[model samples]
Target chain A: MSSKAAQKQAAPDSPQRVLTGRQFMLGDHACAEGALAAGLDFFAGYPITPSTEVAEHLASRLPAVGGRFVQMEDELGSIAAIIGASAAGARSFTATSGPGFSLMMENIGLAAMMELPCVIVNVQRASPSTGLPTMVGQSDILQARWGSHGDYGIVAYCPSSPQECFELTIDAFNTADRYRIPVFILMDEVVGHMAERVEIPEAKDIPHVPRKGPRTAPGTGQFLPYAADADLVPPIAHAGDGYKVHMTGLTHDERGYPSLTAETHDKLVHRLVDKVRLNAADIVDFEEQDVDDADCVIVAYGCTARSATAAVTQARAEGLRCGLLRPKTIWPFPEARVRRLLEIGKVKRFIVPEINLGQMRREIERLTQLPTLRLNHAGGAMPTPNAILEIIRS
Target chain B: MSTPQPNDFSVVHPIDHLMRADRLPHILCAGCGIGTVIHAYVRAIDESGTDPDQHVCVSGIGCSGRAAGYVNVDSYHSTHGRALPFALGIAVHNPSLTVTVISGDGDLMAIGGNHFIHAARRNVNLNVICINNFNYGMTGGQVGPTTPIGAKGTTAPQGSIEHPFNLPYLAKACGASFVARWTILHVRQFTDAILRSMDKDGFCFTEVLSPCPTSFGRRNKLGEGLDEVEMYRERCHIENGAENLQDLDIDIVDHEQPITVGNFVDIERTAFHA
Candidate 1:
């Protein structure tokens, strides 16, 4: 189907994937289908609430397709193995919720530092530690960006629906592979359990990113694993090929070994962080709903965005010039565009109805310096359309 | 799949022929039993003719964590307490990849204690060479799972009153398929323990009584790194697994009690990795 045909079928206000056939699938299940569509060949994960379905789905499906799925002993192992598998020339992913994401932070930093490309699906849940494994929360936004230690760039996408779960996961892999960094599918427990309609297009309909192939053989040619092309993202040669690339958490040179010199560390840190910051616009995927000519805008993401969209539609019926600025990509946040909306004085006030106690609200307010209201919760009970509409009306 | 037989291969050094044992990649501290223990493990691999490429060694944070980096293999250094989980990743990803975890005592006992216990409980086909250095040697010489009674360290400025973890008993309690313990001073014995642990088809935990001299020794007046080596020599008793901790006297050859150094448990269990 053409983009317009699909968009028209989906319409502005319609049941998600309106024209697509549906069967029962949890948010995490849709995410697994998304990974499969994205050519996911390796899955390493520890079973956690809400996110377990993704692991379960991949475990059964990946092996059938001749891919590898490993239920790692824990989330730390889950992300570590994913990095190793990715470096070994496989599209890899892992799924977890709450504390599991915390456990993955260190190695995820290593993935970011080493510029290894892979996807991490975090099915958000209430936490400080096992706080409500079955319940949902959006408290990990700030954590997702800064969770992994050190200064670097990362791409994180939040999908509000199972279909987005399916779609964004593929985009997550594509962006990660293309840029050679870790990408996150930040879904919360609410979206994780939500069974929705999703149509997975043909493999040909989807785009796949194979890593940059080697320029020369191991012995004859020079190929620094950390050496970047004109695009600024480095091409890696897998280990077995014997090019001898190195990876460490410490600051290192292009050869991938530990280099203590200040100049080497500076260049390593700069290039490591710059590529993502420089090309964030191309790497980012976000959605701009009906925000033009609006006096009020609801800026939300994940499941909250779904409700905010409904609230926007309901408020419009009451003759309120309100719109929803739902972000499909959360990190490297759609700052330029959101700021553009404020800079041109397009929207008066942005309202963020997230599950947290104003996590993303402060961000919106800070960037736009506009009055933004946070209709927040800890995510056990999802914010209803009426709750969001009340905030908009207020 | 090619079962390695030690002595069939040439006995060569890891980094170089005249390798300054100090220049080893793991960079073991002066008195660490793990460095010597790794020396034994490398010797076994070389003597046994195991292809280092096919052998993937995994390790967690802490003192013994650097073993994977030192050895010439498809090595992985995962986060603290997760060497087992990641090793399971490599093992299941390629069951033929002789996956092993060389983890530290504090790493396995305190933080990753759960993964260690569960991996033992599940019997995943991964070899775990747990170095029980008795305290948090890498971070600070704090009282750890293997820290004996009255052992003073950075954390327990006063002699510790907390009961120390007995590595053999813990692994046996956790249902580890093969469990053993030996200090670095007992090089041949420790290597013997590792070789036996490696043959297990399920989760194997070989807790080596490694010493940490820098943090653990100096503060406790156990002497410097090499000085701490004598502690391991004097305190350990070569038990044949015939007696229990309760039966063994904690007085002679003792750190509260001479460590029960032997293969305490080995049972045929199904592998979870497959």
Candidate 2:
């Protein structure tokens, strides 16, 4: 059930109608289409709220593209199959919500440790555990960071729009490939399931990135698998490539064999950790909206980014100077931009309206050290614009 | 032509080093069961003659995780209770890599039991050597997945109410292709079982019942009464392996059945990736 086929836009019965303009697509559907366009060959996932359409769309679409789609036993098995497929040289991915995201953790850490590139889309929901499966919440912020134990780094991206969901998903696959790490798309349920005007870009405009394989053979001396070059990613020789590459979750040397000594442990851990953090600029992608004459800044991400833009527009009409700070790259959180806001004296009251009970709020409070109200709602709902405006007014 | 040959410094040839006895490149602790397992593994590898880097060893958290660290082969040390999935990942990725999961009983049967059984049921082509030390030797000998019932130890004060996992029997029931059990006491038997496991193409699991000698040894009378060597000899037996769990009779602290060690299950099936 695997194929090396590329996904093209659907052809219509009236073929010669002189097609112009753009095709409208749902955010979740765009993600599926984007995955196919980016050369995703295999998808294994279970149905979960809001994000179910991504699976449904892919299940029907993959076969048409001559690719593989499997509805696995459960989220755990789904992720396991995807991880298996990814390692087998198939550009693979899975989409899930709160509970499913938790199930993917075991293999997520495996991907991080083994340095296998795979994308996981988590449609954020309200949850301690299955709080509100159908509702929206950004409470999974910390879970995305330290959910899998050990001292390793993973990249998480949050797209504000449906178009971004499509484009950023392709970016997620590219980042996973380039860094040799697991990259997450932590889209809020609101944006994920929401229908919007996503202009599906033609293939020529889409920026596609592929993983680099080793140039030399196994017997060559300079063929250490974990040896990092300028991009902080080593040339990954696939398992079938005869390059003799070994990968694992254990602390290991540059050669990827498990290491016990303090020196190797320190070196190996440093490389895994530093490789992501050092190249943050190449990784960090975000947008700053309307900060020229703003006094208060609402730093937000995911679905809240959409709401914050609305809140800013409303606040501007009410004659309150406010700016919207949105993060596209959620991981290695944009500390520089927050610092930039403080440096510019544009942000006085840094208020963050998140779905969780103040996960990223703490980061803002820590960074700006200004009065940052969590302005949080529990699981199952998004923070209302009126509530956020109240915090700004106060 | 003063070129240093790959096989010149070592007693065993590099070709044997592929999946053979001489390519074990790890440091050994004093009388460690892992060392014995490595000896058996390399010898089996020598016999099998797969590529050195092609034989990938994956292990979960614990001292056993260090096995991959020592070997000069393709290996992975993964999170606790996760070697099965990691090994399965490699097995599915490259069917040619002689896959092995060198982990502890706690890492497998305790926390990793679900993954272990699932892998067995799926019958992925891999070798799983669950180093059963009766207690969590890596974590200072807390009770392990293989800790015998009525044996006094940490986490089980008077005695363990929980019965230990009969690994080979469990694997056989779960559709593994090869299942065997042995003790560190008998080096030759352990090696033989590992070799048989390597030769078998499906999910081959060998539960090597090793003694902690320090933790389980100190707490139980078996540590004092029966020396480590004699304990395995008294309890272990080579069986036809077709014997069901109900038929076997064993008299021990656990009192379930004798630790039957042999080529228990060897069947034909498609691999996970293949």
Candidate 3:
């Protein structure tokens, strides 16, 4: 039997409802639902801990929604397949944890060079190499930014709750489509496995951005596959569309053929890096609280932000003027808004807490250049509220 | 060299529309057999009667991998040794489209061997065309997984002691729906095999023995690409339905053994998409 037919046999027909109203769900499941709600039609992934639930949920849900789910042989193939599927004009994604993410690095570079729009949900686990498969670690934050060799920009989102897992996953897809780049949903193991009450927004209320294909028809005028529009992003034409598009990882001109020259290489690489770098003003997003009147601020993200919030609330009651600056979009680092918080809010000291050896904390220090203290924690565990509160008091 | 006179060649090339004309003259050296393999492949694609628009060509990094860029179709030049997985993505997502993976033996069999065998085991319905040139041509003719035993390469100057892979046997063992081997010298049989694999329903693989004259030939005393083609003419034998895949290893130094080539396996199975 065909895969689609088998999928139909495995699933019962239900109403085509977009939102599964208020209910308690795991962060991983919310991520899967978020992908479904965002019109995900292809999911190619390898099963791994902390992130396996995402593949499991999608495997069960995708076929019911007329989408295809392929559990590839390895993470290398999983990421490669998603790139191919996305190149074929399907909104595609994949999920992996530490070891699997390492395997995907090479192809992730390919996706960036080819400018294929796809989402990668990396449910973070403790690792230098399989350090803690079932425990939380935010160490991949740096890896997500600079893991793949070479200079290119990527958008990574951190979700602190299951609700944000659902909400931000949809946003990640939209961001990927708009930028024609691989966008990352960097979820820690705690957020991935933790269950919480998630409010699924009305389908009509949630916004989704679709990929922009070539404005002119293929075979009309010359179709330059890498020809950037005014916004520095090019329209993607899918395979089997008669576009006859040719793409490569090697540096190419606007025509998308490999042209190994200094001029072409410079132009292509600069444009790729600048697309997100120049558009940082529009792409950077974060959430701030009590910062307008605060003198001390705590910067955090992902699961650590949850602890940071409790610590901040307790510190505020203890007569400390502390607030929270939670970055929703980690890359494109949100420097302007962060600088504004320091200047406008007259913040003196900054406390950054993360579930790693100070990965994102360095970015905060570099961007703000303020007196920052890092509440660093090793992998396999998270910092406690009182632990962060102790730092806030200091 | 003087250009061919206007009347010396046909005014209108029949398969010109199927190639990226501006990118020619290609990077392959004059004696390389890769160009001929591509020629046979385009002919097979033409004869297969599938809409050209419905076909996507994918390749990994190598001299043979450049086939994807030259083809006048939606082609992706993927990372080294990852063509099968990339093609799998295209094929599995759009079952209506035919995704063909054309890459070199080293790129597919060495670094990418895991993806190749697993793809066959899953029956992904990809047209995997492996061009075996005995060494890594683009990277200066180093010994590869398919380099014949006792053959000389830059890395194996004294002579390679490693036992090379029997590609068809590997594919067959991995449960490929169809497996075949041929040389660029046998254009008719090679084209027919390519056409048959393209028309097949599951994981189909074809190994084409081509010449990398600059890399493999110069070191092994095989002369130029054309000289290797002549050697293939004298040494190659069609052994269809040969049961002993283990004995199919190529020993270039051992002239007593004939290089066996033909379709060794073909059967129907449930494809991943179908």
Candidate 4:
């Protein structure tokens, strides 16, 4: 297919594709809208707590805009279906919580190995296995990074409110398309369920990224599907397009044929990791306030960052030097900024507050090696602003 | 110029254009029937008259799953027990493409059973081919969901105590539009059945009883792969319009019982999309 035809099939400009202007919306519902704006051609999901609203909204909305949505038999099928759709050159995604996310790990690894671009939204809830399904938790930070076995690089965005949920979900899709990797939107139960104002821009204002098509023409017998360009990402060809591409989960050579040699595996694995790692400067995003001359910096993300922001305001009113550093991109962990804060030498200590038990704290501690304090709650509730204030005062 | 001799190297196999000859020397064991089944499948595709580019083959993890890798078309070798859902994704997203899943009995009937029944219940448009070798041939002949009662596998040295599934009946019960059964020895019938299924509108299933001489056949005293083919040739009977599918079950231990094989179900239904 021509690139123009592929783009038209992927992103149809229907009136129902976007709900313009500000409106009161749940975070999950806003996320569904973001996907539509990002030209989501397909969505396959199994309903799970704290994330079902995204699937429920898309069920009716997708059909209205000439897209497809399928509620699969289970989480395993959900992930697998999206991966297949992605390989067929559709912008696909799925939503789930902790338990369902656990079921999707194996196929997530398959998607990584195949280098299929898709999005996965995980609305956080308490869990060691079905721990509070209806409550809030930020415990899945590390799980999002290393849940799938093997070495690969991933991109994840933490949306703190309904508005960020709308914006970051679109960013997630663009990143997934640009890098040909699975990007995640990590939302907690608080942000998913909270009703707030979400300003959705018109469809023209939304930035859309299309999947890169094969450079070679069909029937030329020269199309190597796994051959990477200068960006270390391979172009994809869909089924029925006559490229006759072969994709497998095994270690493959540039021709997409299984090559079970250590040299082949080592080359493929390193490219998978370095594609995101070397481009971290462009992938990572964060927000900071009053950190230029502060005695302590509180690093947080997700809904906990909401409370941390308030704590910083309260500390300023009481003549204390406290600042808030909120990370928007979690996986490409915003390490450069944190390292800069440590080297600036104005900060005496770092405070990390989250709903989980010191998940993000360990990341900060490892990166900075400075005095990092954890203000943690197991789940079901956010850390109170005063609790975080107390850590800052210490 | 003199006529080319028979030993001249100018001639190639007829189906060479439809296969990835560079990836040859397939991983199937000696005397296995999967290669024959693949040949029949490729012949059916050729006969169907559909654009080769529009035909996609998906497979799960097993020896038979490698069928996707050999076919020179847009194909995928997905994770274990997930080919049905994966193919469902491709079919639903692009209805113009003809999607087929070729997998083993253990991969399909055991681990992927839920997906199979649900896909049939929804009447999704897909052609699913299950190669039943009566055991997990890739894993060295362990007892699988289709290992008949009183048969011996590596894991069932004392003889398998559990009953096997009647695949056609299960597929018919789950509302498939077309269902059939055949052995690899019946290549003409198998290829025709595959073409018939491909021409149908909803979920279609075909079970091919193949020989695993290295695994299931060696342990069960079934002699070589040719001997197993002879058994299928002598013991198999055609009963296309049988009323009671319940009697279609196979008992390999009972030498007196004849194996029933036919294209049993063919009807129309609304296929699932989106």
Q: Could you give candidate 3's per-residue lDDT for residues A1-394 as a string of tens digits?
A: 3455456432212334255589799999999888888888789999999999999998878887777899888999899989999999878999999899999998888999999999999999888898888899988999999989898879999999999999999999999999999999999999999999999877777788988888888776377899999889999899999999999999888888999999998888898899999999888889987877788888899999988889989988988888998999998787888778766858888888888888887877787767989888778899899999998887
Task: Report the lDDT tens digits of candidate 1 across residue range B199-237.
Answer: 557788777766577877777777776766676676667
What DockQ results for candidate 2? 0.22
lDDT of each: 0.74, 0.72, 0.87, 0.89
Q: Write the per-residue lDDT of candidate 4 for residues A176-287, one digit (tens) a residue.
A: 9888899999999999999899998888999987778888899999999999998888998998899988999999999999999999999999999998998899899999
lDDT of 1 by residue, A1-394 (tens): 1232233222221222122345467889889988877777678888888799998988777665556777766776678778877755668899988788898898888788767788999998876677877887898898998887778888889999888999899899999988888999899988989998787665556777777866877654376667888888888765345454445565667765556798997888788788888887887667766688888888889988888888988999998999887778888888888777887796778888887788888778788766777788876777999998998888
Quote each prediction's TM-score: 0.83, 0.82, 0.96, 0.97
Among incorrect, acceptable, medium and high, the docking class of model 4 is medium
Local lDDT at A14 for model 1: 25
TM-score of chain B of 3: 0.95
Deviation in angstroms for A227 in model 2?
A: 3.0
> Model 4, range B5-40, lDDT digits (tens) per residue?
876756556986778867766889888999988888
Ranking by TM-score, best first? 4, 3, 1, 2
Lowest summed lDDT across 10 adjacent residues in model 2 chain B is found at: B14-23
| Fnat for each predicted structure, in order | 0.12, 0.29, 0.77, 0.70
lDDT per residue as tens, model 2, A165-251: 888988999988888888888988888888787776556556778888876767665688888787667778765455555666666
Task: Compute the DockQ of candidate 3.
Answer: 0.66
Candidate 1 vs 3: which has more TM-score:
3
Q: Please state the error at residue A350 of candidate 2 in Å.
A: 3.9
Query: Under CAPRI classification, how is model 3 graded?
Result: medium
The parts of candidate 3 lying over 4 Å away from their true place are A1-17, B1-12
Best by lDDT: 4
